[model samples]
Target: MTLPRFRPRGWVAATKAAQRRHQAEAAGGPRGPAPRSQRAALYVHWPYCEKRCSYCNFNKYIPRGVDEAAVRSCLVTEAQTLLRLSGVRRVESVFFGGGTPSLASPHTVAAVLEAVAQATHLPTDAEVTLEANPTSSPGTRLAAFGTAGVNRLSIGLQSLDDAELRLLGRTHSASDALRTLAEARHLFPGRVSVDLMLGLPAQQVGPWLGQLQELLRHCDDHISLYQLSLERGTALFAQVHQGALPAPDPELAAEMYQKGRAVLQEAGFRQYEVSNFARKGALSTHNWNYWQCGQYLGVGPGAHGRFLPQGTRGHTREARIQTLEPDNWMKEVKLFGHGTRKRVPLGELELLEEVLAMGLRTDLGITHQHWEEFEPQLTLWDVFGTSKEVKELLEQGLLLLDHRGLRCSWEGLAVLDSLLLTLLPQLQEAWQQRTRALVPGG
Candidate 1:
């Protein structure tokens, strides 16, 4: 099922005006004290790749060669500028995500790390992660990257099947990926994670299980398993649309997910979040911050960051989205001294929806303490009880409410998009009414 796009949906200016009043009320009224700033995570996007994959949808560029020094310098400048803008001094983690961060020189990665260290008090025990493809480089270069201060490696080992690798347009074979995985494991030990794609056309459960078994033998502690999505404008999507390639079957995909979850569980991996499994104490800290709605700074072309922008009285939630095109982003950063193309302040209602949406994606789910940070006056019952659909879901045991707060049952997770669709409209209506009530003249 498709996820709901969390944007405005025909809500008139009245809604916007009401939301503004709601924010005011939240700041000084019964909503209690404003949330204290937390240590923000840092994201450095490396947008270049040697070759674009067929099924990929992220903002990435396949260029001949990038200006390593220029890009490195820009990343530092952008990160420092964001830190200053957000007044966020503490950094808990640094992640180098990308088209393929491995394409950049180790010196470039080191320079970025050094810049982060200089700009903020990056803890000595902070989790530093880098994304790399199997064919990024030889084991020596990967070892060099490890030496360059990257403690965690998120390798793009899309599949263990050579034929599947070809179909996915990946540059590396199964052998290459395995070799890199071994080398990375040797260097980083239990700090490496691998990404696995499921639900490919013509995929069989038996073979898929075999693939997982093979991966578990070499992987450190984490594995991100996701169903293949046919995103629009991607080569694979176009091919499926034109009937050149068959689209993934939903039934087959569900079967794959269930089996994979069971397999991972048996292998001593815990499902920390949907599509992500980890051993005890091995969760991805940077991503956990995202799920918990903690602040983060994204510095690079097409990157996105969310944080609390300082206000006269308190802090307000704001999002920063950078330019998509690499050259355009560089030009903007040069002209404006930063690459942010859009800045949006989320209203209380928007924040509530976001907190719920993202929080429910994890097994731990959202608690009262979590909700009160953004909307102290609000309660889970206030949001979920307004809808008959949610009430029905609760009665049917699809949703659970306990001392730990609201969370989806295993069944609810299976049809999460459907559940979200049922609740979102009701949530919007309730929030709209609440906002209007907060308005001065309402």
Candidate 2:
């Protein structure tokens, strides 16, 4: 699904506003007491890659002669600045996402972690994850990353079939992926996770299941199975549009998804969220924080963040986006101590939309306690209980609302987009009514 684009005011205006607010709060102005200390997650984006994948549309580039030291220093500075600005006193988790963060030097990783430690309380046992490609990560490199305090490795082994790998425009061969998985397992043990893509063009159900089963034998406790999506402007999308390659089949894709879920369940892997499966004690803490709508800070180029700034009332979250281009981001950090491009406070409707969108994807769903913590002034029933659409969904066995709070049935998860479409309008109307009732002259 395509997200709505937001055109924020210029950075200079936003920066000046933020400074004024911070200064007012510091001087004990009308904003009241300082925001209570909070724990948040951290995401560091590595914007460089060795080769661009055909199906990728992330903010990454195959650069020409990058100064690694300079980039490392910029990342460190941004992390410190943002943490201070947000008044987040503790970090719950850290993720190094990328254009293959494995390409970054171990010293760079250590430096970023050290900066985080100095800025906030970084627990020794906090989950630190790094994304790696098989072509770039070897045994020695994996060992070095482990020594640098990365407790988990998310290896992008998209496929075990050489032809499929080539079609996906991945640089690593099947052998290379297997070798890297072995080496990573040796170093990180049960903390390793593998990402596999299914639903390739003309991919049959039998071969897909076979591939999944084969990987299960060698994979560690965690695996993420994703369906191939041909995003616009991607090479694969262009090929399919030009008739150079076949488009993926939606019907076949649905069949594969169901069968794949069954296969993973039989193998003792729990489908904690759509596209993610893990054994007991191997769930991704960093991603779980995201699905729970917990606050997290993003510090690298083109990274996005959501958190409550100091002195905000209630749980309203502010959205942050860093500069997209690497060099430009570094320059901005040097000038302002951060590379922030936009910092917009989310509205009530926007917050509700994000909460439902992310929370409903998980098995735990949106719990009553979580909802109250997020918005103490309103109860879950006030927002959703009176809707006829919700009643119909409950009657149709598509949704459940026991004491555990609202969640989708297995059948509902397969058609989550449609279900959300049915539910969001009701939520918006309810929220609007609440807003009107709270106003003095409504």
Candidate 3:
């Protein structure tokens, strides 16, 4: 199969105004009574890995001397509770993420999926993804998992280099990763995704680019290329601190990222988001919802969720996080019928900040229509229109703003951290003013 090459030559300021206007007009269409749609996704976390990687920081535990049956039961029960609370009739996507969801018994995965379908109206075509470790022999049982309800598979193949995989404390060999990917593709066809990480201890741009090129030969359409961040609590962090392992250089990592972006573009993959690339309709719907600031329900250990309450008046969103410990989560679920350890109602300012932060991470940016969906009283321009910093960023060619909304250019995304430092304060001040006026006492 031949793939088309994409050139980023015309993404300039001269055309941005037109693009922004078109996006805005397209977003604000007929305001008719719509069918009941959830406009949300579901995340079920299975926090157990066969062998924990050194660079990992996500909540995960080793499956040893643990009551596997009870843990599985808790996951199913929590999923049911979330479905009831959500009151969503149609769910767009369901993601099974984890330490290694594939490591769980196929029967258990099927049982939880069955419960989810029964509780909520999960259409047959909804994107159901299961995250798996490449070493977990998932290909051998891909048929069963597919029969159970999973339509997509995301494999955590951090690095294709055997030496680097060893340094990253991966349990699978390079050959094992490749074989498993090939088998999964053969079984599941075009519904497989592979993850690759750059900025390893001693990774070079040349080698990283070659690895990406080789990986595409076995992958379907989706690829998640992430920068390696050494979190504070991870084993790799301690090793780097103690001089046992060398840390990745920022400049070299940036070079790797740029090179990989060009290579993927040439391979017919579009960089829809900062770290994600897909060809045509192969985008990960589950993750796309999160990036677009859409609502989702998360259950299981250490999982987090954000949603607008069913009967809330204002745009005050609620953030929910379940207990991190498996035993504690199960106990809480048994006692209270749910495992939510903390549920905080996010204020308007907090919600705006979140929408801006998450939306800017994607290529589409945030539109006025999207903002008004949550808070009809205010638009993004009402807040950032008069800010000198926003104007300066636009003049500097870092931001694209028209009658529709604001979005970062490719250049802006490169320095998003520093750009946010300048852009967020103005919006925050506006939000503060709006809140103060809403409160009655002077």
**TM-score for each of the candidates:** 0.88, 0.90, 0.88
lDDT of 2 by residue, 305-359 (tens): 9988887885587999999999999999999999999989888678878888899
Between the candidate structures 2 and 3, which one is better when assessed by lDDT?
2
| Candidate 3: stretches off by over 4 Å | 1-39, 309-315, 436-442
TM-score of 1: 0.88
Q: State how far residue 111 of model 3 sits from its true place (Å).
A: 1.3
lDDT comparison, 1 vs 3, better candidate: 1
Clashing pairs in 3: none
Greater TM-score among 2 and 3 belongs to 2
lDDT for each residue of candidate 1 in 204-281, tens digit (9 for 90 to 100)? 888988899999888889999989988998888998899987888889888888888888889888787887999967
- Provide the lDDT at 403 for model 1: 71
Candidates ranked by TM-score? 2, 1, 3
How many clashing pairs does model 1 include?
A: 0
Clashes of each: 0, 0, 0
TM-score for candidate 2, residues paired by index: 0.90
lDDT measured at residue 178 in model 2 versus the true structure, 0 to 100: 86
Residue 255, candidate 1: Cα error in Å is: 0.7
Location of the lowest summed lDDT over 10 successive residues in candidate 1: 1-10
